[model samples]
Target chain A: MTRLAGRIGRFAWEIALPIVVLSYWWLATADGDNPFFPPASRVLEAFWSNWFDERFVSDFLPSMARLGASYLLAVGIGVGAGLLLRLWRPLGEIVEPLISFLRSIPSAALLPFAVLLFGIGTNMQVFLITFVCVWPILLNTMDGVADTDPTMLDTARAFRIGHRRRLTRVVLMAAAPRIASGMRVSLSVAVVVMLISEMFASTNGIGYVTIQAQRTFAFADMWSGILMLGLLGYLLNLLFVRAERLVLSWYYASKGR
Target chain B: MAPLLSVEGIGKIYGEGRSAYRAIDSVTFDVNESEIVTVVGPSGCGKTTLLKCISGLLPPTDGRSVLNGIPVTEPPEGLGIVFQDYSRSLYPWMSVAHNVAFPLAGKGIPRNEINDRVERTLAAVGLRGQQRKKPFQLSGGMQQRVAIARALAYQPKVLLMDEPFASVDAQTRAELEDTVVALRAEFNVTVLFITHDIDEAVYMADRIVVLTPPPTTVSEIVEVSLPFPRDQIGTKELAEFVKLRSHVYRAVKNRWDDRQPGQ
Candidate 1:
């Protein structure tokens, strides 16, 4: 009983500030006289009704699917290209300037161009997110692969471990921590770019719904859309953090020592 | 009879044209089958370059190293190396057991046999029950033992050690030296070990090859006929050990002293 109470106390401690602010919001806006701002309870009620019934299926799920697909594609191609460039130095040197130029162009500026190229749908959304997020992943993986200890390479060579085996076992494993950090940065980029593309050109997705709510002056519904986006970002980050812990446990364990 | 390994006129030149620097210069030697040969020299005397050439990690600009009657243009199948920096050489991400088992991954060996060999090799290095521990979790000496176990697990025809005990403290170094001696006898593997320490050279070698200072070549090769099953205390106490130690020490010192002005 004491342990359960202690656990609850700890949980409450974590949420204390947020709870206070939320209570303040509810009380201050209870009169409902404000034009733009709704009471916290009304926003929550709007969120429960709209998201649970229809908007979640149409807007939220499609947005999340785009995010997942784009992020996974970026990781796959980024890691592959990074390893290739690391192994083949001349190619990296030649392509690096072009990569820099491409990454430097603000992704928002490229949305209309992407829309023309792929047309507005999941394709345009995935293309935009992947294009922007790939840079961090590729560059980080390249740096990580290049920085593998020369002595370890020599050890692998000396042991007669073949090129393929050595690359996978020695180089890839050595670079995993850096690659994982790169992926985290890419994840946020993926989420933001997905939202941006959907807002600019798409007929569906959470961003489109949020904009639609704002245009209609359904302020509580707008708040709910904002709430869903925040939840999506937070939940994705939570999942990524947990996965990273498992994949790079060896790296963290050694660092802890 | 042909030597188990022959290093013939090996030389390594870095850079090009005016900036070309000769790291090794026509160094030559041979290791008999199952013989333990140590190369001792002053620091920066290209001892590592010579070892790298022998192991085929670095291609010599001239000449070649032949192992088991085959030219070592690349890392030969039956050769193993234990590098000096155990921290960098052993994969920190791999457990002690996996690191030992790595070299045999695609050698058509069964998984059970590979595990058996890993277990036996880990036991040989006195790390028997600690197979699951990662390299960083072990002490410096124990990490080196894992490296040695990795080399031993391969059952190489010759083992090349590049100052493998330099990082460890005196007690661990002494213990590791004994382990090498025992492993050498038990495996009957030829060894080409390099160190800057004359005492280490004298202690471990059946014959010691002393190389000159930078742009190095063999200055002398002194034979050590100390009997087998040598201990840290018992072996060093012998007059023969002392004599060989001083001889190699004087040779290394003289080569460094004899370097010309601006060299």
Candidate 2:
């Protein structure tokens, strides 16, 4: 019971600052509101009105779909290309300069190229998001694969482990901690790039709704849109951390960290 | 009927042309089936390079290694190796059981059979109930035991060990040596063990094969006629043991001194 009580006390302490800030916003904007700054209660009401309705199906779902598809695509291509490039030194050398050149240019700058090639649709947004996120995963995966202990490689070879099993079991397993860290960085990049892509091109999704609300005089709805995005980003990160914890349980246990 | 392994005129050279550096120069030896042979040498005297060549991990620049009358162009399925650095050689992500079972993963063996083999091997190494523990969580000796267990589990006809006990404390090293002695009797596997310590070579081997310094070749092969199940204290006390030890030591020193500066 004391442990439970202590946990609850800790939880309350965690939220104490947030609660104070929210209360200040609520009381200050209770009545006399500027045209730009809507009352906090009205923003909450707008959040429910805009997000709790069927409109959410049209706006929120598309954003999630784009984020999920592009993120999955980036992970697959990044890991595969990373492994391939690391395995073939001559090929990696030939392509390394071009990869570095491409990586240096911002994804937003390539928005025009994407618009010309894929047009201002879901594909364009996805292309941009994937482009933005792949670099971290690819670089980290290559580094990890290259850093696999030579002795372990020799052990696997000496044991007569097949080529495929050696790659998956020995090389991949050894590289996982670095890969996980890379993936974590890419997750945040995916979120940022998703917003950028949607705001730049698509007329649908959360970014579109937020932009649309801001363009009009609906300050409360705009604030609600921003709040919804913050919540979504938080939720995605929470889900990612949970999955990372499960995946890297062995890594953490072995490291005793 | 034939020797289990033959290292006939094997040599290794690094780089090309003027930069070419010979590591092992014509190392030739053979191990009879189920015999424990120790290769004792100075550090950087191509001990590891010779082992790697025999294991087919590295191709010899000069002749070749043969296993059971077959030329070894690749790591033979009938051979297993335990490296000195157990911390790097064993996978950290795997549990002790999984590490032991790894070599058998794709061998088309039944899961139950693999489990049985893993359990049996771990038990033989005195790590029966510690199967679920990770390698890093164990002591240096235990980790080496796990490496040994992994090799033993593979049921290799020939086991190659490169300074396996060099990384552990004296107590653990003694325990592991005893374990190997006991294990050999039960498993009946031919072992080619490498070490820098002459005492270790004498204590653990049936025959001590001494190698000279860089561009190394077998300088001498001193047979150990010491009795079986030799204790650390009793074995060292034996007049025969002392005489054999000195003989092997002098052979190694004589070769080393022959290559001294100005000579």
Candidate 3:
């Protein structure tokens, strides 16, 4: 009984701040005089109804598919380009200025150009999200690959490990920690950019639904959409953290020593 | 017969124009087949530069190194190197057996052959049961054993060791020295060992190629005809060992000191 009580106490510690804020919100909004900010109970009720229905299929699922495809593309291009640039310094020197210049254009500004090129729907969304999020991933992987210990390289060469095998087996493994960290940063960026691009030009996604709810004066629906977006971001980041722990356990284990 | 490995007038000059530095003026030496030759020099004496050129990791500014009749323009396929930094040289991300098997696996050797070599070399280095542990998880000496095992797994024509035992403790260093001495006999591998430790150079080598301070070249080649089965205490106590140790010591230092301290 005491052990169960201790476990409950630890659980309560995590939820304490959320409970306090929620309670304050519920009490303050109980009068229902405000249309812009709905009562907490109504918003929670809408959260269930708005999401656990057809919009879940139409709105949430597409957002997820886009997020998955775009993030994968970003990682693939970022790591591949990063490795290429690191292996060839002269190429990096030639291309880096152009990369920096491209990175500086506010992704919002890049969207219209992208929309004209790819013409709305999945391609545009994937294109915009990947463009915005890939820089951090690329830059981090490049730095990590460049930072590999020279002694390790010499060891590989001395042992007659071929260049391709050396890069894949040795160089890439050494740079994995940094690559993972970059992916972590870019995960959040990818989620945010996905929403923004959806809002700007998407026909149907969580961002489009949320913005539509506000425009149509369905404030409770808007609150529910916001809640679901938060949950989606939280879930993705959680999954990524778990994956990072599994893949880079050695990097962390050696660190603890 | 021609020497199995030859460092033919190897010279290296860093940079060009005003900032040019002569790291190795001219270093020439040879190792007969299955012989252990120690290249002993002081710190900052282009010891590493000389080895890199010989291994073909670094191009000599003038002349070339020949491994069997082939000039070494790239890391020769038949040579293995155990670097000085044991921790850095053994991939920290790999398990003990995996690090040993890396070169063979990289070469697309059959899995069974790689596994056999990995098992044998790990046992040869006294790391028989610790194959699953990562390099960083092991002691400094054990990490070096993984490196040595990695080199030996390949069955190279010549092994290049660069002050490989420098970082371990004295007890561990002594044990590793014995391990190398035994492994050399067991594997019959020619060794081009580089170190600054005079006693080690004398103890481990069949011939000590002592080098001048900087802008370095071979100062002398002192033959150590000490009988096989040399132990640390027993061999160091011998009169011939003492005389040859001091003789090579003077060649490295360019003068004599009676104290005979460890460099």
TM-score on alpha carbons, each prediction: 0.96, 0.95, 0.94
DockQ of 2: 0.76
Which model scores highest in TM-score?
1
Off by over 4 Å in 3: A1-12, B106-108, B255-263
Task: Name the docking class for model 3.
Answer: medium
In model 1 chain A, where is the ten-residue run with the lowest total lDDT? A248-257
User: Model 1 reaches what TM-score against the true structure?
Assistant: 0.96
Candidate 3 residue lDDT tens string, B1-263: 99989999999999999999998989888899889999998778888888899999999999899998999999988899999998889887889988898888746689999999999999999999999999988999999999999999999999999999999999999999889999999999999999999999999889999888668778888889998898999999999999998888777666222223563
i-RMS for every candidate (Å) is: 0.9, 1.0, 1.0
Model 1, A16-128: lDDT tens digits are 97788888988999988996889888999999997888877888789889999999999998999999998999999999999999989899999999989999898988999
Candidate 1 lDDT by residue in tens digits, B1-263: 99999999999999999999998888899999989999999999998888998889999999999988899899998898999999999998888999999999998889999998899889988998999998999999999999999998898999999999998998999899889988988888888899988888888889999999879889998999998888788999999999888888888887798895665
Stretches of model 1 off by over 4 angstroms after superposition: A1-13, B260-263
Interface RMSD of 1: 0.9
Q: Give the TM-score of chain A, superposed on the true chain A, for all candidates in the order listed.
A: 0.93, 0.93, 0.93
Clash totals for all models, in order?
Answer: 0, 0, 0
Q: Which lDDT value does model 1 have at A233?
A: 86
DockQ winner: 1
Task: List RMSD in Å for every model shown.
Answer: 2.8, 2.5, 3.4
What are the chain B TM-scores of all models?
0.97, 0.98, 0.95
